[model samples]
Target: MMDIDVPGHIEKVAELEGHDDRAWCVAWNPTKPVLASCSADKTVRLYHFSKTDADTENPSVTFVHNTTISTGHTKTVRSIAWAPSGTTFATGSFDSNIGIWEQESSDEDDEMHGEGVKTGEWECMSLLEGHETECKCVAYSTSGTLLASCSRDKTVWVWEVHPDADFECMGVMMEHSQDVKCVAWHPTEEILASASYDDTIKLYIDDPSEDWFCFTTLTGHTSTVWSLAFSPNGRYLASSSDDCTIRIWERIEQHKWECVKVIEGQHERSIYSLSWGVGKRRGDDGKGEFGGWLASTGGDGKINIYEIYEPPSSSDPKGREPPTHTLIATLPSAHGVHDINHVSWCPRQGYEDLFATAGDDGIVRVWRINLNGQ
Candidate 1:
């Protein structure tokens, strides 16, 4: 029941309805106008949006139901991730399998929607089966050359993407003693990070011999780590946990990371998801010297947004200061008494302030930051 009319707050702009069961995750297409959401209903829905009045202060965005894939998974589809090419995506399901999806036809065969927006039918191109239990999360590398998946089986798998929709398993990491909750890749590197029920985060890198191995283990959270996100610059990482806190880790040296800051007293329950985006704000020189915005939501049925500022210039000879963050906005009961399972910023450049959240209400809600409160 929080008032969203205040300045510098986040406003709910659209509610997308289709899934008959709880929606678990949402992902934005990196190169298209499409947004994808997966649900416990064992389906994946795609929505396309277009913006009007791009130069105006109050731009309008219209979202249309693009299509829905039956997803063939026997159980709930837990997570989805889009490739950098936007031509393909991957889904991890509770059925203990991963599905690689792609359009059945090329763009020339796509159907046209409002304003000539293109839409296509997608099909599962490959099915990867290895996880012993539910596949909790999936993510593609920045270059789309590798894909990472973690599961309740307590293992992380790395796959090499081939041209004809083929995936070759490169490694299987069993570093976590309990269920792995999420997996994320660094924005500009091949480094892969995974959070787990073991209350730890592990980072992996490809060795010179072409084998992927755990390089470091990060520990600080007192409870299960639920999610992980890297700053836009990839120099820092943020992790949310069942401890109801977020920890920021900075890369201090080559292959070394240290916890520099801990964010607390923001959420009343476990933090399920968080995302970092290149925000609209800039530094004094009118350049993007500062960092981005971080959005988080969880079992408390609330959404919080924080503005992350770059560490100030310091005279310390050893290193610079750690980044600082301020809570900018929050919305309670974002889904009307339903827990939000995921939040993701739109990856497309011009729409950085827009983000989408999936909730236990079986709805995907789109929101925008109103810095001017208009």
Candidate 2:
């Protein structure tokens, strides 16, 4: 394989093992030092990590297996997502059900199960069933008041989260012509986006008097769109496709988005997953004017990281220039020939450089980007 030289080195930190089948997705808790992964093994694994010297430049971190949730799904647990509050999480399964899970409040069972299990028993608080086929992805809105799930049934369902694990179906959106692969919520808005095998993406919003409706459709990908992610600032969106390309879209106007960039020559095979994070670098004001880092991985077993940045004021006086990206690092054969199914950056504020990937090898690997040979 040909190597693409880059500035940073991605070093593997830990290999979390437990899943008996292919691991499909990994998500980091928004408020805690926990990471969650789902698998075809019909289980969810949680890992907790801590920093030894948190205040120093080089901190030693250790990851311990927290617990295993034997989600009572009949098929593969395809996707998992954490609520922004970190108090609850949702799981999507090929059995066509979405499970809402929460930890029991009583600290009675603090004993280890076998080798790694620890603290707080989790329970399936709610089970959502409506999809006619496999549920592909699940995501929570920024405020944790809403949850969105898409399925092979070609429909996107939005649910209103309520107290005591009660959930009400808000709307069922049927805008895709084929299997819906992924669903993502806008960073700071109520808007939702879904990608499909129809090679298109549809955006939806609540119409207040009329309920949720499709407002716009994004078209440009020539093949199945596998995943979708919104930028941290919510001004832009990124998508990966089976065509082996990534497309960047800019919200040019209210209720309108246009494709501004197509990233090619990165992955040679289908791109399964991508994530955007508030990276360590910032622009002039120390705010995140420089956009952030975009990480993608898929069938080729490679992990690619890119820095997305906006042009300086002098270069674009009217500020009309769309953000651009450059590949800063690449790790080939990330799973040693097994396809990497998902990549997610740690959502916590101080751990932007950290990320985890789930692979067909049934292992969840943690990695950190070492910049400037640090």
RMSD of each: 2.6, 3.4
User: Could you estimate the TM-score for every candidate?
Assistant: 0.94, 0.94
Q: Please estimate how well model 1 matches the true structure, expressed as its whole-model Cα lDDT.
A: 0.91
Candidate 2 overall lDDT versus native? 0.91
lDDT of 1 by residue, 1-374 (tens): 43553347788878999999999999999888889999999999999898878778678898899899999999999999999998899999999999999986656655655344344578889999999999999999999999999999999999999998999999999999999999999999999999999999999999977789999999999999999999999988999999999999988878999998999998999999999998777336532247898999999988998888876545352477678787777888899989999999998877888999999999999999887635
- Candidate 2 residue-wise lDDT, 7-103, digit = tens: 7878898899999999999999888789999999999999998877888988867899989999999999999999988889999999999999998
List the candidate 1 regions with Cα displacement exceeding 4 Å: 1-7, 53-56, 106-118, 282-288, 313-319
